[model samples]
Each structure stands twice: as structure tokens, then as C-alpha cells.
Target: MAFTNNFSTSFHWWDRIFGTDTKYREYRARVKAAKKAMSKEQQLEFERKLMAQVEAEGIVAEAEAEKMSLLGGNKKSKV
Candidate 1:
């Protein structure tokens, strides 16, 4: 699934006009609980693995391009 914590807590909204905020709040709480349940070594391993998965999925490049575009940066070309 796509990332959830970006626009809002649960759903992105124009304002308080719409949202299913509780699910995100609950999700976040669960994440925090799980993290707390991990030992420090386990937490480090978990983060490393999660980041590796994202990179393997090619999200790192996509997110980098999106960030550059948002900042009015031009795409870089390799020569």
C-alpha cells in the first residue's frame, strides 16, 4: 500500500471537509506500540529492512523526483 502519513493523519483533506482520521490514528498507535515492543537492536534492523524494501520497490527514485519537481527543480540528466 501507499504511504499514509503524508497529507494528513489518515486521509488528505481540503480542510475538515473530509477524513477517516481514526484509522490512521489507530494505525500510528499500533506502529508506535510495535516499535516500543522492539529492542534497540531489533528497531534498527526493522528500519534498515523497511528502507531496503522501499528502495527495492524503486520508491526512493520516485520520491526523489517528486520532491525535486515540488521544489521547482529540474530533472537531472546523466551524460
Candidate 2:
């Protein structure tokens, strides 16, 4: 359906398995387009809901620290 780059030369798995293949690229593009369409506000709302659930379980602090570390921030000092 959607054509972008040279699917034949871009992908190399086709020659190894069977022949030329472009189906994977189409599937990937569709998934990426869907993700790009999601609004930032929707993402934030989902995060808020998730954080509230974690807070209710008394693990919000731990979860937040983990998230910060993943984003290259320093974890809490043991001292």
C-alpha cells in the first residue's frame, strides 16, 4: 500500500529465505504511523492514571526512581 524507500534493496532477508519481500516494511510503517498519531495529551493522561495506580499500591516512589534512572537521572543517594 504505502511506498517509501526501495523496499527491495533496503531489506536483505528476502534473498536469504525465499525471494523479494516487502510485506514486512508495510506492516512496520503502519504500526509506526499509528504510534505517531497518538496525541501527547493522551500519553500524559495514560501516564497519570498509571502513576495513580502505582501510588495507591505504595510503590510510586520506587517506580518514579526507576523511571528517572532510565532517563539518565541520578537515583536516590543511599547516604
Candidate 3:
């Protein structure tokens, strides 16, 4: 025998009755408005800033991993 879950089905039914989540809709609207309002140069600058932030986060993560490896925190112990 197999068990099936209907949680998503009920949640979707409620969503249809009450409309989609408000916060998500508002976030999408804000992003759409921001994109629409940004000039070409502004958009390019925003993209550059976003890419820089992403690269910075990646570098930070890599440094953390390297530090952990150096401290032997990532080693697996055999029982």
C-alpha cells in the first residue's frame, strides 16, 4: 500500500479562493516597477552592483570553506 498527500491540493484550493500570497505578489510588483522605472544606465549599474555582491558572497563562502579545511573541521571520523 502507498500513502498519498493532499496538503498541496488543499492549499492550492484555498489559494484559488483567497488569491495568491500577498507578500509574493507585492514583491513581484515592486520588482516590476523598479525595472520599469530604471533608465538604461541605471539598470546597467544595478546589474553591476548585483553581480559584485554575488561575487563577494561566493568569495566569502570559499574563504570560509578553506579556513574550515585548514582547521580540520571538515574531516570525517571513522567509528
Highest TM-score against the true fold, candidate: 3
Of 1 and 3, the candidate ahead on TM-score is: 3
Please give the lDDT score for candidate 1.
0.56
lDDT of 2 at 12: 60
* Cα lDDT tens digits for candidate 3, 1-79: 0011112444856544566444334444655676788998987787677556656655665666666684455666576
- C-alpha RMSD between model 3 and the true structure: 11.9
Q: How close is each model in CA RMSD to the real structure? A: 7.9, 14.8, 11.9
- Work out the TM-score per prediction: 0.35, 0.27, 0.43
**For model 2, what is the C-alpha lDDT against the true structure?**
0.50
Check candidate 2 and list the clashing pairs: none
The top-ranked prediction according to lDDT is 1
Q: What is the alpha-carbon lDDT for the whole of candidate 3?
A: 0.54
Predictions in order: lDDT: 0.56, 0.50, 0.54
TM-score for predicted model 2 compared with the true structure: 0.27
lDDT of 2 by residue, 1-79 (tens): 2222223554566533663344444445655565576787865665566445544544544455566774544655565
Residue-pair clashes, model 1: 0
Error of 1 at 77 (Å): 20
Candidate 1 lDDT over residue span 35-74, tens digit each: 9889989877876776566455446545665767845447
Off by over 4 Å in 3: 1-33, 70-79
